[model samples]
Target: MNQQALSAFIWSVADLLRGDYKQADYGKVILPFTVLRRIDCVLAPTKQAVLAEFEAKLAAGVNPDPFLFRKAGQTFYNTSKLDMRTLIGDPDNIAANLYAYIQGFSEDVRDIFERFEFATQIDRLAKAKLLYQVTEKFARVDLHPDKVSNMQMGQIFEELIRRFSELSNETAGEHFTPREVIRLMVNLLFVEDDDILSKPGVVRTIYDPTAGTGGMLSIADEYIIEHNDKARLVMNGQELNPESYAICKADMLIKGQDVSNITFGNTLSEDGHADAKFDYMLSNPPFGVEWKKVEKDIRAEHEQKGFNGRFGPGLPRVSDGSLLFLMHLISKMRPAADGGSRFAIVLNGSPLFTGGAGSGESEIRRYVLENDLLEAIIALPTDMFYNTAISTYVWVLSNRKPAHRKGKTQLIDGTLFWQKMRKSLGSKRKEIGDADIVTLTRLFGNFTEAQIATLFDANGKEVGRRMVHKGEFQPLPPEGGKIKLAPLSRIFPNDAFGYRTITVERPLRDEQGNIVVGTRGKAKGQPQADSALRDTENVPLSESVANYFAREVLPHAKDAWVDEEKTKVGYEIPFNRHFYVFQSPRPLEQIDSDLKQVTGRILQMIGELSA
Candidate 1:
């Protein structure tokens, strides 16, 4: 059956959950069962062979673990004599049989169900008189790889989880990211290393700190395989949510990956793969969420490790932990001498320009840009997430910058590159289409300044749109029509986003207009600063601070001097300000003419009314 039909069939099992299970509790029953059935079907093809191998090895007094894995041709296998079909035949002992079936699986697979709290669910279902019926319903569906490709199955899994999270009023976005967004990120992550990735037998590691059901890792793996079948990716991820972790582990198991690589815990508090560095990474950490729970641990690391740990760069405010994940990914990058690493992370607008100078957020941005780690920032369309309708950006950072990209950052305005979905899911009303993905990917790959020209006809309807690169001829509209040009892709030196926030202080003057000078310490012979007259000015990093002070500050305040001690370097990508296009207002004559015409029309209408 197709994915939609399969998903619908599986979701229909909720019918048995009605009354006994609240809408919120339906997922506890459906999610684990779906995973169980999928695993059962996957192992069904070689079940007998695996069982025979296990028994033969056991009789021969040899360890059967290796033989069993080989026979099953998968990372996991089951030694139980019963399958889903057999469990249905004995309804009177269905609970015991089901428990046995679950216990028969390998340790890794068993761990997945344990985290799902499957035993409790089984007991709950049995107590409600729905265990046998639910088991039979799930057993009837075919989730074999042949019937449903891994990609299709992943989609079905995400869809079901999304529905369950929505019904339960949980944050669905924390569990999964939209596939299109992941695709675009994967594309950008690999775009610069196409040659190396396409090589035969190229093996690389990809990680996600906030794995969220392993969607990002799965997509990146699929992308590499699709491009070069011989290429291999070792996927590693860590997740905090129990259910998401279980699902991610199951996915890794089915894909023949070492499920141990996918850890369960808070990444910030504990580093699952402490000494591990990866070739690439992708993450969509919980956006705008606070890190207060792990503040002590994170701060301890920042203070004690100081440039030696993941969060050594800085820690954002307790209110938003998005930057902490970025720092974590930065620490995971393989060093440039060792082939380096590239990663893409989805972040809300806050990270782009959140805190001011010396603040945690600003320090994080300063660290990334000053070190030339940022490659690009793509502004995605708003309302693209399932939980929130706020603007988001995909930040691409890399330590192994190609010669063409070094010391330069590209900003692609992709806010308009979306199509309205036929059906909205939660807060998500738009989707990045395949064509939109291609366009954005091309812009990043090209790494050039370009503008999007929208051609309008004489009547002002949009006729066509085209992307024009710098130094290229602009596309013009038809006769008597106008063309609107906006920056679609722009490139800037890394320092363009950097600025020096200088504290400008003015001397305190007495009522008689005499300057007040400090008599002791550091200010011994210097003029005392007036707190009321103190102000700060942000000067672009591209310009000399001294020159800027002379040109802009001196003219306004002759006595204002830069307080060097209080000066702090900061970086912020004001994405909108750089691409803002200003349009002049209509002339007074035009406005007067329009007003006169409106007045005449109103007079004519009033005259007609009198008649």
Candidate 2:
């Protein structure tokens, strides 16, 4: 069966779970059983041999892990004689047999079901007398790798998770990112290195700090293998949610990866791969989620291990820890001398300009821009996620940028490159089509400032669009029509995002309008600054501070002087402002005509009623 049918078949088991299980608890029983059935089918071919080897090793008094691994030809093996098919033979003792069958698997596989809390789910099903029916429903289907690839399985599971999350009123985005978004990120990530990645023996590592069901890792692997069959793509990740971690680990295990590399628990509190680094990384951390739970651990590292820890750049506010994940990924980047790393992260609009100068958010932005790690940040269309309708951005950073891109950052406005979905999924009402994805990828690869000229018919309906490159000929307006041009891509120097927040002080004066002079040490003859008259101004880093102060500030306040002691350097990306195009409103004649038409229609309706 295809992914949709398979997902539907698995979700069909929910019929037996309803009334016996709450809508929120349906996933608890269904997901574990689905995974169980898949693993059972995979181990079936070598089941007898593994059992024989286990018995032989036990008789000889030796560890059989190595022997069993070889016998099963898989990372995990089962020693129990009862498989999914056999459990149904004795429905009266189904619970006991199922539990035993689960315990028979290797510790790693068992741990997944354990985190899934399968034993409790089993008991709950047994008490409700729905265990047999649910088991039969999943067992009747096929989930073997030969039939369903890892990508298919991940998507299927994500669909089910989406349904369950909706029933529980939870955000599905917290569990998995949309596959199309991952594709665009992967394309942007691997585009510049196409020549390097196409080599036969090329090897690369991919990691995601927030591995939400391992979608990003799986997509990265698929992309590499598709381009070069001999290329090896190593996947690693960490997840905090137990259910999500279990699913991610299970997916990796079946794909023949080191399940141990995909870990569980809070990544901020515990560094699963502390001393490890990678070549490429991607993450979709929970949007606007707080990091208060791990504040103690993160703060400790930032304080004592300054510039020596993962959070050395700085910490974001406790209310939104999206930048913390970015910093964590930054730490995982391999040294530039050893061929540095490229990473991408999905973030909300807040990170672009949330805090003021010297605040944690601004400091993080400063570190990224001043260090020139930012390559590009593409703005995605709103309502593209399963949960949030707010505008989101994809930040691509690299320590080893090409010579031409050095000290410059690209910003592509992709909000217009989306098609409305046939049917909405939760908050998701739009998707970036394959053609649109191609257009976006080409725009990024070209690294040029471009605009999209949209042509409108006389009645104001969009007819077509043309891409306009910088310094190139502009498309002429169509006859009896109009054309609107909006920025599609923009490039800026790294310092363009930075500024100096200068505090302006004015002389203090007595009630009689006389200057008040200080009598102490260095201030003995200087006028004391007035606290009430103090104000601040932000000067662009591209312009000299003194020049900006003289041009814009001194004219308004003749007595104001720069207080260099209180000045701070900060960075922010006012992304939307660059793409905003001003359009003059329609002429008064047009408005008067429209108003007259509306009034005429209203009078005609009234006259018809009176007649």
lDDT of 2 by residue, 376-488 (tens): 99999999999778889999999999988999999999999999999999899999999988899999888999999999887888889999999998788777889999999
What is the Cα-based TM-score of model 2?
Answer: 0.97
TM-score of each: 0.97, 0.97
lDDT of 1 by residue, 1-611 (tens): 88889899999998878999899888898889989999999999999999899889989999999889999999899999999999999999999999999999999999999999999999998998899999999999988988888888889988998888888777525778999999999999998787646799888999999997888999999899888899999999999988889989998999999989999999999989898999999999987888899999999999999999998878888998889999999999999999999999999899999889898899899899889999999999998988888889999999999899999999999998999999998999999999999999999998999999999999999998998999999976789899999999999999998899999999999999988998999889899999999999999988999999999999989988988999998889999998899999999999999999999999999999999
Instruction: State the displacement of the C-alpha of residue 599, model 1, in Å, after optimal TM-score superposition.
Output: 5.9
Q: What is the C-alpha RMSD of each candidate to the true structure, in Å?
A: 1.8, 1.6
Find the 10 residues in a row with the least total lDDT in model 1.
167-176
| lDDT of the structure predicted as candidate 2 | 0.90
What C-alpha lDDT does candidate 1 achieve relative to the native structure?
0.92
